[model samples]
Target: MARASRVAALAIAVLFLCGCGTVANLETGYRQGWKNAVIYGGVRRDVQSAGQWIDHSWTWGKDLDIIQDIGTVVGVGLVGIDIPLSAVGDTLTLPVTVPIAIYNNSTNRASVSRKTDAAPPAAAVPVNEK
Candidate 1:
């Protein structure tokens, strides 16, 4: 039992250290999980991507071999484990991440507005007479 527990812990640590969706979200301004107040955005995003992959595999990969099928199943299983883990990470760090996401959004909007405001209006083109 202790061995099993230790193995599980090590697996989780490896997954966490390998940079899952939560890490990617942090690096990308938390864009994946910022929509939800509870911060399940990262999981949702990961699921969507996984769903797309599965959908594409079924739709486009009509002749997958045994090895390919096994690989897909394993990939999906890993994602299954990753989704909840990412959700937990996002939830745990919500206090810090939410504020950072808000700041990034605000700054992005402000910069866009500034650029638009600074741009001059286009002048009318003159008509060419024969």
Candidate 2:
């Protein structure tokens, strides 16, 4: 019974830790976080970057060799497993993330408007009255 309880606890711990997207998004602030969450946290981004890197690697080129293809498949499979976990996390955290995103948006817009107002107007072009 004690061993079974320990196993259950470990499983719960792993589930929480596997939510890489939620952690990454929350750390980077709302705007970027929101974007990351939308794009499957960092799953899509990581895969794309990895593919590009492999394509450019000396051992690999635009055409993936069998070994490289298998590696890519494995990497994608791991990321695929994380996708649903991240989606769940992102959904659960929406209440928090949404407010932060709104606040960041408003503040950025206010700052930009202030800067525009502070700048001097452009020189007016001379015109002849008919």
Candidate 1 structure quality by residue, lDDT tens digits, 1-130 = 9999999999778557543766666655535554333345567667776776666555445467654676578558648777777877778768876776687678779888887746577888988999
Task: Name every residue pair that clashes in candidate 1.
Answer: 33-41
Which candidate tops lDDT? 1
- Write candidate 2's Cα lDDT for 89-115 as tens digits: 666667776776677678779888887
lDDT for model 1 comes to 0.67
Off by over 4 Å in 1: 1-19, 28-41, 60-63, 117-130
The C-alpha RMSD of each candidate to the native structure, in angstroms, is: 11.3, 8.2
Query: How many clashing residue pairs are found in candidate 1?
Result: 1
lDDT of each: 0.67, 0.61
